[model samples]
Target chain A: MLTQRLANIVFTILLLIACIWFAVIAQGFEASGLLASSGLPSKFFPQLLLAFTGLCAVIIAGLYLIKGQAGGDSGETVFANFAEARRGLLMMVVAVACYFVWKRFGFVPMAAVMGPLSLLAMGVKAISHYAIVLALTVLVYLVFTQLLNIQLT
Target chain B: MYGDLQALMTALTHLAQPVSLLLLVGGIVLGLVIGILPGLGPPIAIALALPFTFYLDTVPSLILLLGIYSAAIYGGSISAIAVGIPGTGAAIATVQDGHKMFKAGQGGEALGFSLTGSIIGGLFSVICLALISPLLAQLAAKFGPREYLAISVFGLVVVVRVAGKSLSKGLLMGGLGIFLTTWGLDELNGTERYTFGSYHLYEGLPLVPFLVGLFAMSEVMIGAERVLNKIEFSDSSLKVKLPGLRQLSRMKSVLLRSSIIGTIIGIIPGEGAAVGAFFAYSEAKRKSADPDKFGTGIPEGIVAPETANNATVGGALVPTLTLGVPGSPAAAVLLGALLIQGLAPGPRLFAERPDLMYSIFIGLFLINILMMFIGLIAIRFAAKLIMVPTSIILPTVMLLSFVGIYSVSNSFFNVGVLLGAGILGYVVRKLGYSIAPLSIGFVLGPILENALRQSMTIADGSIVEFFNTPIGLTIYAVLLLTICWDRITALLRRN
Candidate 1:
């Protein structure tokens, strides 16, 4: 139930803070030897972009604070209901978990569990959907490993 | 001209091979299937297939991706007509009249007109690409750093302006995309920027993985949110019927005008297919005898957007191939595919690989022609594709993204970048920002930085001197006009 106005204000403030942090970090960048006297310093472009981005963020924050909308979702919430939010957030967690699983246990285990975990996240109850997804996961594994000679692990 | 002809012949000989022919057909089928699926568009389709291209020769790979590119744009119309939901952003304009016509029990006829118009628009744009690319490349060959800077600015600003309703939000995302590119060792000074002590970050974030994750993985998460929603359609209306020669002849003017509009818009860097479709649709409605009847399931309504959207494929390649600036977001991903092949796009490509250039031109023509036959057979099966449950697709796409990106380098870092990019894309998109400017900005970042540095060196910090070149001035003039066009129209209306 996050409103666009409230969300933009919060996001813009955080973005402004991040831009300042990155700009300070950019000050540490240095060049050596012949590259030292190049056309411009390495930090110039990034800092300039950060400045512009920060400026835009401030403008957006002001627009939202004053007008209460930025021309999208005037009075609507970010998600339709709790179910949609839960599904979306859980899917994101599942995706990240799959990545970590792949990194820790190799490709096979990750591929095997990714589908069922995702189906569970989406609240699917159909057994046939799981079967088809499992078959697809296996097919993908075989194609990459056998046909293309790619090392999945 | 004779050399071009010889190159075309060589390309024809290469495409006539059994392997190339099979990939071409396979690419079209894959493209159509992907296009018919809601939430999967050309960029994602090309991104998923990009890794497979790493295994094949340049000619076959480019041919396969080109088939996907052209057909995907055309394929979007199928779902637009059969259901109210457009499979791609380009097909949104088609839904106004296309879906209405389907409910009127003229589904087959609606599909036919869209298919025919798409083919015609696509073919016309290919012809334009063939005739216009060489000439444009000749002119682009003379461009200097300042000219490139102007072009990069024009491309970024134009894309940001059109990407969403809020300019500030779009610009913020665009700036963030370019800023991310500044990570790693600087190409100009070799100074470490934001590598964070990882050798993998030395060369900066990999393009293919970042792009694939941005388009495909983000859509997967978004699709996951609506997994329970059901798509309903009638299989009885899925048959496709080609319009008679007389029907096509009557709509000749609409087809030609839309083709021209699409191609011109496509040649303008960052305009994209959706803009072209909407513009052509508005123009068609404005010129009609009864503009009020436009959304009431008229043939002209379907034809304008369909033709223009497909035509953008050819038109967009004009800038992408000639100037190294992508004409659309899909073309931006196509640019990544080119970089993966170690082939840099621009005027240099035309000279260095005339055969490849010829192959693209000839290959596009073949894809459009072959799409008509393939679309006829494919329409009957589209209902099944359209009904694919999102729960199944979301996991499959995420898996593909992870595996496909990892296969690129066998590097876990690239996979991490993919996941990171997907999250960033999801957050920004959910906040009402368009991914078009971000993707395009990332692609243009290196070019923009290099050009800016070089131009500053040449100008020696003189701002006026940077604007002295005729070509740069011309590009800036066009950009200025484009920016002020709406304001000028508003002023005239007020007067």
Candidate 2:
């Protein structure tokens, strides 16, 4: 289980690094012609926001490091146990896989398999739940295709 | 007044159409169903319905979405009373007293009180919206870039203050949300910032898909993790029993006060229904003669939060329609729906589409009236909905999100954005951060950036001139006062 104290420290550090990188990249931004000289530069707002974000990330990381909890967390883990983590991470992967499947094989194949794949990811053993989810998938497909006149293919 | 009456007549003429009427009822039913399901809320309900509005006329679409907005808040109490779980965050305050009442075998009475109080509160706010919006719109119409900048700053800061326990985490998410908007071509200079050679990135990010994914898809993943949890509910106590006039009269003051509190809180940007509900609950408990009786199956406990939560629907729309600023995250999504209809929200919308404006006011009144009937019928079956396993809901919501988002633009890229946003939302939510600031900041980013740059140009590098406007100064003063209000109260109490 990943405790919030550890998670915040790790995540905020990565976020701070990303903010610095993005801010540096923002320096390369340039407007063409007369617009370049008109008012603030395009990088101004992004860099300002990056600075604010980086500052907040630093504060959060510092708080977590010093107190071991930022928001009254009471040193609780992010997830309760391994089972909860497995379900959550697996579902995320399934969601991504469903998106890629739609892009690769098209919406029909994706639609047919998404229900079963998601059911598997969630560790469901009920046959009726699978049937119901599949039925809902078909209903969604019909609503888009027939009622809304959306081209699914 | 005569013009208001004329517009009301025109709104009635439009709303009399069969399709509009059907969609309005359908929206309420959908909202009720979704709100009865644990882990789904008004924002998710509105987001999922946003894409369907693409095929609808402006009046029906707005009507449909408004129906969903109001009823979703009301429907949350059903599950709160029937089971221990609150179907929406707005219902969290209801759970203590509501579930207590259920366990005490007064569930029907509890449901009835919640339903009636919600209707009264909702109607009160709609009346307030109708009376106040026109005046607010007239005033807001005079706002300049500086005023808008002040308003945006106020919105973001207030949201960050109240969104999470850690101010830094909320600010980090809010800043991150605004920073992401700086991608694609800069509107001021047309300079490519971070398009990264993709035409899809040319628009920065699609608003509706990103928002829908953030609310709905994230919940789906969370729901997936809790799939093994089982809910047991008995239908025997599901019937609603209306309170008598005498019973209502006894609690009339509490109801009235809560409605006012909810409306005022709703008018403040970033203070959402959940906040209003809890605020009203605390206030009611403070004012009660037997304050210790709260959370012990009392009618006042149920009424305070239910009324306030429903009232927030109307209060939230006041700023959204008048100032082009959302009063709540749900209203932010509602604003996105308006943008999709090719209508820009703000003071001009009221002047340009008086009938549509009247439709919202009049339509809300009708929705509240109609909810009494629908809620009665729906409560009898709402128990079964609460019992539906999350494993079934997870897959269905994911599929709907994928196909619904794809159907919006017929573009796979938008779907990709949806998936990415869902992952981002899930990650932040798991790490003890609230997504309210993120969503609201994303919605307000364009306005904030545009206002700031334009204000800077108007000021010509003079900081004093940027704060020169009377309206801007007033807004800033109010923001400063709001931030210090708690400390001021604490000092007074000490004294």
Candidate 3:
């Protein structure tokens, strides 16, 4: 069956791996010379937490294996078809692009593009929608900088 | 009695000052705006206001953040009624019937009922708070470190169970959240845990930045998903019609019952507002003479959840103010605000400042009174909020979050943390993990570790001594009973 449930299962598994990696890192954390004996050593809580987290992931994975309800086979996939999934993925790409644009060109310039780019991502082919969205961006910028007196660099 | 009178006078004099009043109203208005805005919830609202408190006195600052918190939860209902989408997670339960009413051309009526129910619920919880908080404070004053440890376990367990659909998911997230807080130098023995040689890591990850990112940034990602797939929708009517006194009086039982239900649910460590709302709603439905009339744009459907959910604000505050333990995610952030203000929550607060307690009690009352007017005015413009595109809203909120986290410490590392937290929150949320346990775990982790270490030191490594205290044992017993709550309910149903 072509379903998002498989993807969800993979997602949880990745998180489990991330937790184990954090635990390994925690174990390597070196304690300073004299102060290690003040309490139950600093690594106790972090390692305990990691073990619990690992146990949880294993149980969750087991549940998915047996019941198939863990990753949610609710038949609620937004990307049930190719076109919708493409548009949604494109929107994420646009948001990431806007982040980089802000990093490079600064807030005002990136903000100017974000509104229209998002509209384009959603397949809104209307000039009116773009105009309205652009106007909103300018309005928000003015309110933040002029009215609220926040310095937008 | 003489010491009590002196403390009370000090409190009264402190609250009588003019700045406190301004902060209260300003906080409410600010909270309303943040609550109305999607992806911006109480944690971000409070975190953004955290630095402003560094200059102001503790009382006014606490009042400001508290007002915002209570009002924001109430404000979330506005967007939930106006649009099919909930403004905050707490309003999620409201969506089942709230959006239904909106579709049937009763938007104005639905908004009115929600506003009225919210105010009533808020007022009821405030009254309960005035009566019960002092009593709890009195009882908690006798507790020691071991007692606190027991209470911490009770609180953490209660929250983990109530937080999500699966207990393992809650445990995993909660464990990971608590583990992350151990990243700085240990306060007790001065041993570094996971600081990685950075001086900025000296104080651990700053609560304000972490909270701002967790609530605000995660929202940006979720908002982006909706942005690409959003359906255009709007409500035409802008007028709200108030329910008559007779109608309100008729549902007084429902309002009272739901408020109590909300308060009790909220008092449980992590049941939170959304859970309280639906629980109250279902309870009302089951008790109703005509259950079939439910969810058909009826007044009862709207009233129960709104009343119960709003009541939760005051209910949630009870544990946070009494113990350092937060009753909900919003209250957890409020705890952070209190800590930033150099005010430690717990029994000392009651002994040192009962007047501050009175102020919160009275403040909740005033917030409820103000809500009647503010909610009515706000209902008219609710449609405008619905029309705001989630795409633009998402980016703007992300910008605000970035600017806000940067403004606090002027450090780029904080911004990186915000982004990291956002991505982490997005992944966990997508994988069906609740953020409440994580947020609550982060807040409670330090307290838990401190109490655990101190209790161990005090007991000289004796495991039996840890649970030897009578007070600690009682709390443990109560917690045990709480965990078996589902079985109790099942037995009650079968009987």
Candidate 4:
């Protein structure tokens, strides 16, 4: 089990690195010609935010490392158990897969695949649940294509 | 006054269309159904319905979303009373006494009190919105860049302070949300920051799709984890029984106080309905002659939280409509709807489209009145909705969100943004960060950037001049006072 204390510390450290990298990238931001005279550079706000975000991430990492928690969920795991984590992570994968399917194969194929695949990802074995999800997928298709006159493809 | 009356008349004419009327009825039913379901709150309800608004007229679209907003808050109470598990965060306070009464076979009466209290509180706040918005808009019209900077800072800082227990975590999320907004072309200058050579990045991330993903898709993924959780309820005694005139009159003071508390809390940016309900609940209990009886099947216990939660609808619209700042997460989604209508929300919105303003005011009032009748009928069907399995809901919501975001602009890039945002939201939420500040920060990002740059230009490197405006200074002072209020009170208590 991944505790929140361990997870947040790792997450914040990664976030701090990303912020620093983005702030460095902000230095190369350039405004063209007349736009250069604009009151502030394009990078100021983003850099400022990156700096602030980095500072907060540093503080949070310190709190978790030293104090063992960040106010809530003292010593609690990120997930209730391995099953919950697997289900959640699998759903995320299903979402990304659906997006790629829709983009490459088209809406109908994506729609046809998403529902049953999602149920499978969640380890659902109930046939009625699959039927209901497919029915909902078709209903969504009709609402968008027939009623709203949208070109789902 | 005469001009305002004529605008009101015109607004009524717009709202009287058959499409508008039908959507009003349809919106309430949908709102009630969605609100009855666990894991779907007002923000998701509004976001799910947002894509449909692309094809309708502005007034009808707004009416549909507003109907959802108002009824969704009221609908949460029905589940709170029927089952111990709250359907929305706002109903968490209601479960104490509401479900206890249900077990005692007084389910009908408990629901009746919540319904009536919700209506009274909703109507009261609508009246307040009508009275207060114009004055607030007028005052907001006098605001300059410095003032907007102050208010944006105030909104983001206050949201971070109040949203979650960890200030640093909230601030980190808020900064990340705003940082993402700076990806597109800079509005002040033409410099490209993070467009990555893509034409779709020219407009920055699309607001509607990003928002829909952040709320709807993230919820779907999170909900998938609890696919097998079962809920049981007996629908036999679910019929609502309205309170007698005597019972209503007896609780008038409680109703009035709760309404005021909810409205004031709602008017403050980021102090959402959940906060309002808890405040009103505690206040009612504190003021009660028999405080210990609050959670033991008491009507006042149900009325206080229900009334305050519903009242937050109107109270939230004040800041969202009059100031371009959203009062709550749901209101932030509503702001996206306003943007989709090609209307920039601010004080100028009132002057430019008085009919629209009048439409919102009158439409909300009508929604409250109509919800009472619709709620009576909707309660019988709410049990079925409550029993819906999370496994079924997760995939269905995910597909709807996918199709809905794609249909909004007919672009796959927007859908990609949707997926990316959903994953980000899911990971952050799993790690124990609230999304309120993130959403609010995204909405307020452009405003904050423009105000900061313009104020800097005006101040010309002088920090003192940047703080020169009286209105801006006053806003900062109030913000400072708000941040220190707890410590200030503690010191005074020691004295």
lDDT (Cα, tens digit) per residue for candidate 3, span A1-153 = 234455556766886787778777777655576766666766777778778877887887777667765535455453446655555556556656766676788778877888778777766676877887787778767765675465656
User: Better model by TM-score, 2 or 3?
Assistant: 2
Question: Candidates ranked by lDDT, best first?
Answer: 4, 2, 1, 3
- What TM-score number comes out for model 2? 0.99
- After superposition, the stretches of candidate 4 with alpha carbons farther than 4 Å from their true spots are none
- Indicate the residue-level lDDT of B187 in model 1: 91
Clashing pairs in 1: none
Model 1 per-residue lDDT tens digits across residues B250-282: 888889899999999998888988899999999
Quality of candidate 3's docking, in CAPRI categories? acceptable
lDDT of 4 at A71: 68
Clashing pairs in 3: none
- Candidate No. with top DockQ: 2
Per residue, candidate 4 scores C-alpha lDDT tens digits across A122-143 of: 9899999999999999999998
Mind giving the per-residue lDDT tens digits that candidate 4 earns over B339-445?
Answer: 99999999999998899999998899999999999999999888888888889988999999998888888999989999988988898999999999999999999
Task: Give the Å shift of residue B454 in candidate 1.
Answer: 0.4
Candidate 2 residue runs with Cα over 4 Å from true position = B1-6
Q: Residues B1-495, candidate 2: write the lDDT tens digits.
A: 227777778899989999899988998999999999888899999999998999899889999999999989988999999997899999999999999999899999999999999999999999999999999999999999999999989988999999989888999999998998888899988999888889889889999989998999998888888889878777778889999999999999999999999999999999999999999999999999999999999999999999999999899999999988899999999999999999888888888889999899989989999999999999988978888888888888888888888888889889988999999999999999999999999989999999999999999989999999999999999999999999999999999
**Winner on lDDT (3 vs 4):** 4
* Chain A TM-score values, per prediction: 0.97, 0.97, 0.83, 0.96
